[model samples]
Target: MSSPFIVVPTYHELENLPRFTEQLWTALPQARLLLVDDASGDGTPDWVKSHLLYQKQLFLLERAGKQGLGSAYVAGFSWVTAHLPTMEPCTAVVQMDADLSHNPDAIKDLLGALDAGADLVLATRYRGGVRVTNWPLRRLLLSLGAAQYVKLITGMPFSDPTGGFKAFRPEKLGELDLEQIHSDGYAFQIEVTHMAWRLGWNISEVPITFEDRAAGVSKMSTRIVREAVWRVPWMALHRRRLKPRTESAFAQKRSSS
Candidate 1:
């Protein structure tokens, strides 16, 4: 089986990149790492370019400016799909944060789920119980509340619907209409998973330990929160008429309960 392609959206994440890259490679040496940088003024692109000179599996996609998170992933995914034949073939596409909030060690479990026949595997923090570190109570509560709100609005049964750490089958990810994805921030996370869920993909969740970024500032803002608040309901209203290809274990469990 081919290795996975890891897409990480970065904005001024220089401090965390080295550690993240090292750990990720250590855990999955054969995987390719793509850093979609939004013109980070912190020499992020420069570092990537220098590494690219020697690191065969390391690739960089430098954007003109700070595009939203959703667009960054779209660009990364599109790049992977467009260049699949030329580069090392990959079986999966993984998306995660650059700020170390998404642990690299847990990547194996996410990919393992895909290897076990899951179409999409979410690295969830709320599967059995909350598993977050260094987060304030207010932020923690907001995240928990957001998960509940997304479930209520979209009827998606996955815990931690807004989590960014996820893996997708390369073909299944390419099937998504990338141009149609407009939501960003928390809404973006929900939108992608909802699309997969609607298509009846075998989505599964792997419990993970999430830690707040030890370096750099978070991009969270009032605008991101507001976008999620309104965009979620709009997504439900505009959802496609497609049904799942197969009922996921989570959905089946939820139904039985």
Candidate 2:
């Protein structure tokens, strides 16, 4: 009876967890959520175990200490692939933040994109002219600049490669070396999207209105930014060396022959 799982990476998000589950269920009642918490010492684990554990669709993975966003998702994906029995109509994995910044209502759009033959659907803030709300000018510029920089380096045309709101087909996701993804924070988002593109998944960017979190403090830090700054170029170089031979490339080569 397993189903498509939504991997939500949480860290000290006690206040947002309740509303997150509520809104998410209201939107997609049948969807399963895997809350990967990185030792949020604020009783997040206890609350989820007490209130949500009984639900057949809700699950949690508790880790010791803040183990970066990339690893949390890698763990969640591995767990789902290992433990969950794939059923009909369950073809994709979702990744989103626990904070309300990413609208729960948009989950349908993302999944719909997957159903419409998209291997990877990215909920982009820059798709339809900067669809973000409440972000200060400086932060907005940083995000936009980062996306542009990623595009220039990785040669991926995604408008929001750094965006966290995305859906991926399990088949497409399985092609990636998940354990090899070690970038933290926004860098992880970029790396995953680039990896999917390199794997030749049909990546579609859907416009989403990203709002600032209403309840919790932001997690953006100099360290995370520094990591992305250093790692993105290196990823570009690595991608150049180990370019995945996608089906399209193979078909083109055969046709030319």
Q: lDDT: which candidate is best?
A: 1
The per-model lDDT (C-alpha) reads 0.87, 0.82
The worst-scoring run of ten residues by lDDT in candidate 1 lies at 244-253
lDDT of 1: 0.87
TM-score of 2: 0.90
Clashing pairs in 1: 200-244, 200-245
lDDT of 1 by residue, 191-250 (tens): 999888887889999999999999999998889899999998988888856543344333
For model 2, the superposed segments whose C-alpha errors exceed 4 Å read 1-3, 52-55, 86-89, 241-257
How far residue 87's Cα lies from its native spot in candidate 2, in Å, is 6.9
TM-score of each: 0.92, 0.90
Error of 1 at 48 (Å): 0.7
Residue 116, model 2: lDDT of: 94
